[model samples]
Target: MTTTDAVRPTGPGLGAVLSDAELAAVRADFPLLGRTVRGGRPLVYLDSAATSQKPSVVLEAEVDFYEQRNAAVHRGAHQLAEEATEAFEAAREAVAAFVGAGAGEIVWTPGATAAINLVAYAFSNATAGRGGAAAEPFRLVPGDEIVVTAAEHHANLVPWQELCARTGAVLRWFGVTDDGRLDLSNLDEVITERTRVVAFAHVSNVTGAVAPVAELLAAARRVGAYTVLDACQSVPNLPVDLPALGVDFAAFSGHKLLGPTGVGALYGRRELLEAMPPVTTGGSMVEVVTMEATTYAPPPQRFEAGTQMVAQAVGMGVAAQWLGELGMEAVAAHERELAAELVKIAEIPGVRVIGPVDTADRLAVVSFVVDGVHAHDVGQVLDDRGIAVRVGHHCAQPLHRRFGVAATARASASVYTTADEIIAFREALAGVRAFFGVD
Candidate 1:
C-alpha cells in the first residue's frame, strides 16, 4: 500500500503518520508496558487522565536519587548534603522552566490538591482580615465573593467552598451549558467588584472543554480579583505557559505528567506568594523562632513545611525534561489524533458522549455513557479485556449532575497512546451492549 493509503485508512479518517514501530519503541520506554494483567492479557492503558504510566527515564531518575545522591537538602554540613541540595534546587529550576515561571516562584507540595489548598487557606487567612507587614495583599473581607465553575474537580471546588464558609465571602460559580462547555455568558455578572478571588480549571476534567483563559483573566483583571488556576489537567496534556497566561497562581501534579507521586509544584507570581501567609507552618518554613515569637522564611520556603520529597522532585524534573525534549507541539499533535478517534467512538450506536465533540477546543479526555449499561460494568468489561479506563464521577460530581447522569466512563489519552489502542477500546466498548443484553 502507498503511504497515503496506509495513513488515510486509519480510524476517524485522519491523515496522520502513526506507525506500529514508533508505538512499540515508545512502549519499550515504559517498564509497566511489558507486564501483563488478568492472568495473561497485554495491558492497554487508556487512563492517562487519572494518572500516567512513568517512563524508564523518570524511574531511573528516582532510583539514581536514592543510590547516588541521598541526603538532606537546604541545611547540609557535608558533601552528600551539598550534592542533594544542588540536585533538589536544580529540580526546582527544571520545574520552573517546565511551565514558564521563575525558579523562585515554584513551591513544592505533596500534589496538586495540596498546592490548591495552600492558595485557598492563604485566602482564608486574608478573609479573616489577618495581615502583618508581608500579608497585606491577601486580605479578604465580608461581602467579598469568590468565583469558580461547576466543572471544577473536587480539588478545585472544596477548598474554595471551605474558604467561603470560613471568611463569610460568597462563593459563586459559572454553570455548564447543555453542550458541556462552561457558560461564560455570565462572566460580567459573576465576576463583579465583590469577587475577591477567581479560581477555575484550565481544562474541565470531565468535559475536556478548554476555558477562555484570556477572556476570563481579562475579566478578573478589571475587578482586581486574584486568579488561581487548577492546571492539573492542562499542564500534563497541553503546552502551558503560566507567566504569559497572567494568572496569579497555578498548581499541577508530577504523577499525571509521567513523574512520581507525592511530588507536585505550585506556581505563584513572586509578589503574590510573598504576600500570602503560609498555610502549613513548621521547621523548614521558619526563619527563626523564640518561645514568644517566630519568624518565617520568604515565599516558596514559607509554604513548604517539614521534610521535602527530594527524590520525587528530582524524578519529576527528569520527566519535565523528557517532555521538553519531545516538545509540547509533538505531544499535542499526538493527542489531537487520539481525540479524533475518541470522538468517533462516541458516535457509536447507543453511545452518548458527555461533552462537546469538537476536538479542536478540548484535551483528550472523553467521557461517555453506554445505554442501559452501568459505568462500573462497562469499566469491568473493558478491564476483562485488559483495557484500563476510569469509571464513575471522575471526582467531578457536580459535572456529572449537570450532564443528568449518575456516572460516566472516561477514556483519556496521552503522548504514549496509539490509534490501535483507541480502536481496541472501541471494539471492547462495542461488546458491552451485546454482553449485557441491552438494546
Candidate 2:
C-alpha cells in the first residue's frame, strides 16, 4: 500500500468530542493560545505533556491568594495566618478529592520528582533505622527487590536506583514489548516474594501507552509489595482515582494538570504516611521542639517541611475544580479524537511512529522519528511553522534505548487542542523530511 493509504482515517471532526462553540470557549479560557509566533503564524501548541498552559482561572486563583490571603500556613494564631492555613488545607482537600483520596493522604511536594525522592529517601531512612519503630515496614535489606518497568521516566527510575544503592536492595524491571506496551508476561517472576516495592508509570510519557494497572496491582498485591504510581501523565489526561486503583502511593505534578509549576502532590495511604518517616524536617512540620529532641506533626504536615507553596497549591486546587467542572469523561473523549488524528503521522514517508499505532490504550502523545533526520532538526522545522513540540528522550532514556533511537519528536494534546491544530501539525511534519533533504 502507498504511504498515504497507510494513514488511518481521521476521526469524526473535532466537533464529535467538543462542539465548535465549546472548543472556542475552552480556547478563550487559555490566554496564551491566542498569541502568534514565528512572524505572526498562530501557535499550534502540542506539548502539553511537557507542561500545560494555565487557564485564566488558574492564574487568577494564584494572584488572588497572594493578594488576599498571603501568610504562612499552620503557624500563627492571627487572622491572616488562620485564613491562609484554611485556604491551604482546603486546597489539599480539593486535590485529594480529585484523585479519590482523603485530605490526610495528600502531601505537598515541589513536584512529582520530589515526591518520588521523598518516598525513596524514606526507604533509606527506614533501612538506616532513623525513623525509629514506626518506619519498620519500609525497611529494606540486601536481598530485598524494588521492581520498576523499562518505560519509567527517569524521575521514577533514578530514585529507585539510588534507593537500592543506599539500602543494598536489588532493582529489577519489566520489559517493554515491541509495540511499546509493558511486558507483563513474566509478572510472577519479576515481582517475587523478595520484592519490597513496585513502582511504574500509569501512562508512559514517551510511548503514550497506558500500563495494565489492574494486572500490575494484582502482581504487587500477590507478593505483598508496595505500589507507587507515577501518575504525572495519567492524572492530566485520564480520570485517576488512587484509592480505587488500590495503589499504596502515587505522585503527580500540578503544572502538568493545568496548574502552576513548583507544586506537586504525593498521595499516600493515610496509615502509610503515618508510618513513613519524614524526609525533610524543620519548622511548621514539628509539634514540639527542644534543643535535644523534636516531635513532629501529623501525616500531611509532617511531610511538608519549611514554608509551603501556598499560592501554587491554591492555583492547583482551582485547576482541579476546573477540570472537575468540565468532567474528565469529556476531556478523555476529546483527547482520544486528537490521538486518532495524530497517529496518522506514520503515513508520511520516512516517518516512523515510536508507539502504538492506534489510540486504544494511549493518551494523545505521539512520538516519531524521521529515517534520516535528527529529532532536533525535525523540531526546528515544526517550530518554524509555529508548531511547538517536545524534542528529546522526554526523560525516558531507557525507553528510547529500547526503541534503538537516541531521541524523538513528540506532540502531545491538551483540552484546548483542536482538529485544525492537529491537522496543522501533520502538514508541518510532512515537510520535515524534505526540508532536511531526507525525503
Candidate 3:
C-alpha cells in the first residue's frame, strides 16, 4: 500500500453503527482475522483487550518506513534522515491528535508499562533534586500518599509501588465492589490531602469496567495531586480526550491500538511534561552536554532518550489515522453490542461472569469463571473450538483476590468481532462444565 492507500481502508463508514456487510468489510482489513486455528475451525478472536490485531494499513506503514525511507531520525541532513524525522514526528502528531493532546506533550516509550515507569522514575529523579526548583512540585516527601485502585493491571499498580518504595511515600488504593465496579463511595477519603499522585486504569482489564474519570479527576484536583491514567484499555476501545479529561499524564501501548508492538506513548500536560525531569538519559534527548555535565532537551525529547522505535511509531500513527477515518463512535458502538452478547455466557448453568453482566459503561471484554472447573481448562475447551481468549488473573491479581477467585477465562471483542462469533463462544462455554463432569 502506498501513502495514499494507507489513509483509505476498505472498512466501515464513519461515525455510524456498522451494518453486517460493513462489519464483514472491516474484518477483511485485518488479514489474521480470517485465518483458522486448531484443525481448520474458523478463528473467533476474542482476546482483543489483551492486544489487538493490526490492519493492512498499519502493516504497510511500517514496511514503507523501512523500505522507502529508513534512517536515524533527528540526525543527518540527507534526504532519508530528513524524511524519516518527518514521518516519525508526523506519527507523533497523529497519535496526539487521536487522544486530544498536543504533539509536544506526547513522548514515545517502549510500552505503557515503560511509559508509567518513566513518570515514576522521573518523580524519583525530582525527589533526588535532578530538575531543581521546577521539579519541586513533583517531589514526594515521606508519608505522602500515592493512590491507585484495587482493579489496576500490574503495569499501573507496580510502578507506584516501586515509586513509593523509592520515595518513602505510602501506597494506597480504592477497592473494587462485588459487581466489579470501582468502589468510589469513599473517593474523598482515598484521595486525601496527602496524596501526591493518583494513578488508575481508565478501564479495568479484568472487569471491563470504565472508571469514573470525571469524578476521579475532580477528586485528584481537589487535593492538588497529579493524575496519571493507565489508558491501555480505554484508548483502543473508546474515544479518549486527555486534555478534556485533564489528566496530568496518561499511558497506552501501540499493540493495544491495532498498531505494532515495541512502541507506546505517554501523554502529559504541556507544563507538567516541561517541568518533569528526565528518567532515561544519553543520546538525542540532551540539549547540551559537557564532559562534566549535560543539559536536557524539552518535554518529550528530554524523556525520550537514546535510539527510538521509528518504524513502529510510524505504524502507530497510521493506525490512529485509520481508526479516526473509521470513526471511534462506530468502533465503540459495535463493541458495545459485542459486550452485551458476551454477558449472556452467564445464562449457562454453572457459568459465572466475573465482571458486570449489563452493558452499562463497559467495553466488550468479559471475564468469567466456571464452577468446579479451572480457568485454564475452560480456555482449552474454547481453543479446541477455534475460540481464543485470555486465561488467568488478566494481570489484576488484587481484583481477582477481591472477587475471591484465583483466575478467570476472558473473552474480549474488538471492532471486527461478529455476533456469530459470540454465539459460537457461548455455545462452547455452555458445554465446559459438562466436559469437566461438573454439570
Best by TM-score: 3
The CA lDDT of each predicted structure is: 0.86, 0.90, 0.91
lDDT of 3 at 201: 93
- Tell me the TM-score of each prediction against the true structure: 0.94, 0.96, 0.98
Model 2: colliding residue pairs: none
Ranking by TM-score: 3, 2, 1
Give the residue spans of candidate 1 off by over 4 A.
1-22, 129-131
The superposed Cα distance between candidate 3 and the true structure at residue 358, in angstroms, equals 1.4
> What CA root-mean-square deviation does each model show from the true structure?
5.9, 7.0, 1.3
Give the Cα-based TM-score of candidate 3 against the true structure: 0.98
On the 0 to 100 scale, the lDDT of residue 394 in model 3 is 87
By summed lDDT, which 10 consecutive residues of candidate 1 come out lowest? 1-10
Q: Write the per-residue lDDT of candidate 2 for residues 1-439, one digit (tens) a residue.
A: 1111111212234224666777788788899999999999999999999999988888887887888889998889999899888878878887899899999999999999999999999999888987789999899999899999999999999999999999899999999998899999998899999999999999999889999999999989999999999999999877889999999999999999999999999999999999988889888888899999888888999899999999999888878877766667778889899999999998998889998988799999999998899999999999999999999999999999999999999999998899899999999889887887877
Error of 2 at 274 (Å): 0.8
How many steric clashes does model 3 contain? 0
Give the better candidate number (1 or 3) by lDDT: 3
> Model 1: per-residue lDDT, tens digit, 249-324?
9999999989999999999999988888778888889888999978889978998888899999988887787776
The positional error of residue 436 in candidate 2, measured at the CA in angstroms, is 1.7
